[model samples]
Target: MSEIQNKSVALVTQIEGALADVSPSDRAQSFLERSLDLYFALGGPPEAAAKLVTQARSRAQLRVESAVANVVIELAAASHLSDIDMIQAAYNRLDVELKAERSKK
Candidate 1:
């Protein structure tokens, strides 16, 4: 694969691993944000944008069956309580962004 493709794949892997010890919802939201950023960063054909969002949502739903329950548990286990709020805020921001991006479709 090309370097950019490699980078994207690596980022996906890293996101997954980072959130593996986390809760399902958090993992989904985090991965989606990370993927969306990479998708935007590597802008190209419209096809890429379409595929990127689809893949991101796919990753999110895949976490529904996961062991971790919600974003809080994941955040608390992964970081300090102070940072937990930040993580939720971040996830909310990403959720808004993703919704906007999807609305354009």
Candidate 2:
């Protein structure tokens, strides 16, 4: 599996280990501490992983919104939208956007 997937599995294992403890608050605190330690190990700063996750989610949302806007504008320019014709145009625009993002990377 990938590095992130391996980290996720380790997180699950940590939570499972904590589940057998007697105190609920201790278990929760332990889980959070373990998770934060892993994030710090992987991302350096305490908040680095969280920032990366937030940025990734924002980027994904922007991509979806951009693709939808492109579809609507392109279809509107043609003055009519059928039930299925806009699918190809929208996907083509998303493909272009993906290429652009990849090039920047």
What is the C-alpha lDDT profile of model 1 across 1-105, one tens digit per residue?
Answer: 655445444444544444346564555576667646644544546567777667856864635535334644654544463444544555565556556655755
> Runs in model 1 with CA error above 4 Å?
1-21, 44-105
> What are the models' TM-scores?
0.25, 0.24
Q: Across residues 1-105, which tens digit of lDDT does each residue of candidate 2 receive?
A: 755445444444443543344654555576557546645544458556678757856864556458557645854544342344544554565556556655754
Could you tell me the lDDT of residue 18 within candidate 2?
A: 38
RMSD to true structure for each model, in Å:
16.8, 18.1
Q: What is the lDDT of residue 77 in candidate 1?
A: 47
Among all windows of 10 consecutive residues in model 2, the one with the lowest summed lDDT is 77-86
Question: Stretches of candidate 2 above 4 Å error?
Answer: 1-23, 47-105
Evaluated at residue 91, the lDDT of candidate 2 is 56
